[model samples]
Target: MTEPADAKAVRAAETAVAAEAPDGAGASIRAEHLVQRFGSGRGAVLAVDDVSFELDREPARIVSLVGQSGSGKSTIARQVLGLQRPTSGAVTYGGKDVLRLNRKQRSEFRRNVQPVFQDPYAIFNPFYRVDRVFWTAVRKLTDLPNKRAADEAIRDSLRAVKLQPESVLGRYPHQLSGGQRQRIMLARIHLLRPQFVIADEPTSMLDAQTRRGFLDILQDFRVRYGITTLFITHDLSSVHYLGGDIMVINKGRIVEQGAVAEVMAAPSHDYTRLLLASVPAPDPDQRWTERIDIGQIR
Candidate 1:
C-alpha cells in the first residue's frame, strides 16, 4: 500500500472506531457458520467446513485454534483476518460483516484487526531498514506533530517488546534473527493495540526457550492492554499455557470445542483425543499412545 493510502486507511479507521462507543461487554469477533471450499462440483475440496466460534474482547482473552496440517486451522485464520472469503457464512467484528464491509468500514477493520503470520521474514521487505515498518505504522496509525514525537513513540513500543532502538533501527530484515523479527512484529501490533489479533504459528520457528518467552510476551500484552487474540497453532502445550478456550478442527470442521480444562480433561471427539494424546509426556513411563479407535469413531 502507498503511503497516502495507508494514511487514509488509518484516519478512516480511527474515525469509525471513535464513532462507536465502547459497549464494554460483548463478542468482539464472531464467525458464523463459515465454510470455504476450493474448486467446484465433484472435484471441490472443503478447506473449512461449517466452522463457528467467538473471540471475546471485552474482558480480553486468548482463543486457540488447534489442528495439524490440512486440518483447516490456517484457512480459518485467513477468514478471520479477512484475507480470504469463505464460500458460505460470515466473519463479523462488532457485528459488521467483514467480507461486505464498505471502504470506511474496511479501514476500521484494517486498523482494529491485525495479523501475525508464521514466517516473520515474509512480512518484511529485505531492502528496507527493519525500523521502517514501525515508523510507517506510527505515521499512519497516529498523528504525532513531527518526526521527533513519532520517534519517541516508536522507541517506547520497541521497549515494550524488549528491543533496543539503536540495535535494530538501522539493520535490514536479513540482518536480524528469526526471533528478533517476530518480536518486531509483536511490537508493531503492540503499538497499534488493535481490538483483535490473529496469530498463526507465531512461535513455530522459535526454539523451545524462545517460544516460551514469546507466549509470555503475548500474555503480558493481553493483561496490560486487554487485547483479544486468536492464537492458531498445532501445539497443545502452547494452548494450555496461553489459558483460553480450544477448538479442535478436522478436515475443515470443528469436531470439539470448550474451555481448556474441560476439553483437556475429557475430549469427546476422536480427533481431539488424538491431538491431546500426541502431546509428549515428560516421564518416559507415561509415554502417550492413541487410546481411541479412530476407525470406529469416524
Candidate 2:
C-alpha cells in the first residue's frame, strides 16, 4: 500500500514538531526594565522606557501592545525578537539573556521566536518567486532530509493558512494581493511553529475584511498550535477583536495593562480612556460627538 502525499506531509510535520519540542520544564521570554535610547545627552530620545513583560512557553496566549505611532510598541517588539539591543535592560529566553546567547543558543532562539513584520512586500524580494521565502526558511531552519520533504512541508504549511499552493507557489510578490502576501507570512509562521510570534502591526496594510481574517488566523494559531503572540497594533478595535491581555502604551510607557474586556470597558488610565474614546462607534447615532483634545489627555 502507498501513503498519500497529505498524510506524508502530516507525518513529517508531526515528526519535526516532536523532534524540536523543548526538553525539561517549559520556558519563557522576559523583558526586564528595557530602555532604548537613540542618540546622546539632551538630544537622546527614549524609545522604550523601562518596559517589562513576559510570554510563557506553556499555555499559549496572545498579548496585545496597543499604542499610537511613536508609542514605542514596535521597539518593544524588536527588543523581544532580539533584533535591537536595549540601552539598559535585558531580553531573556529560558533564563538566558538573548543578547549574550552563544551561536548554538542564538540559532535555537531564532528558531523558537519568529516575526511576522508589518510590510509584506518589503520582506519579499521583487525579482524572486514567492517560493524562495519558504525554501530559504526550510534550508536555514529545518532538518528535513531532502527537497521533496521540504516541498511537502511548504505545501502543507500553505494549506494550514488556507492558501492554495498552486496559486501562490510560483508567483512574485507583485502578482499576489496584500492579503495573500500577508497570509504567506502567516504560512511561514505555521511552518516553523515558533513558540512566540511577534506580529508588529501585521493588519495595518490589510483591509477591514482582510484584517479580520488575519486576526482570526492569529487566534487560530493560539488555539490549534499553542503559539504565543505579541500582537502590536495601534487599532483598539483589533485589540478588542483579539480578546486577551492588552497593554496600553503611551509616550514610551505602558499606561495600563489588563484583560481586553476589562480595560476596554473601564480603563483606569487617562491615556487608555482617550484611546478608547478615539475608536469610532459602529452606529452613527452613538458616535463620538465631542472633539478630542490630545493636549488634555496625557
User: Which candidate wins on TM-score?
Assistant: 2
- Residue 40 in model 2: shift from native, Å? 1.6
Weakest ten-residue segment in model 1 by summed lDDT: 287-296
The window of 10 residues in a row where model 2 has the poorest summed lDDT is 1-10
- Measured by TM-score, how close is model 2 to the native structure? 0.87
Q: Model 1: per-residue lDDT, tens digit, 81-175?
A: 77678899999977888878776566667676777767778767678998878876766655566889878888888889888988888999999
lDDT for model 1, please.
Answer: 0.75
Q: Which residue ranges in model 1 land beyond 4 Å of their true spot?
A: 1-27, 282-298
lDDT tens digits, residue span 98-145, model 2: 889776666677777877767777777789999987887787677788
What lDDT does the true structure give each of the candidates?
0.75, 0.79
RMSD of each: 5.7, 8.3
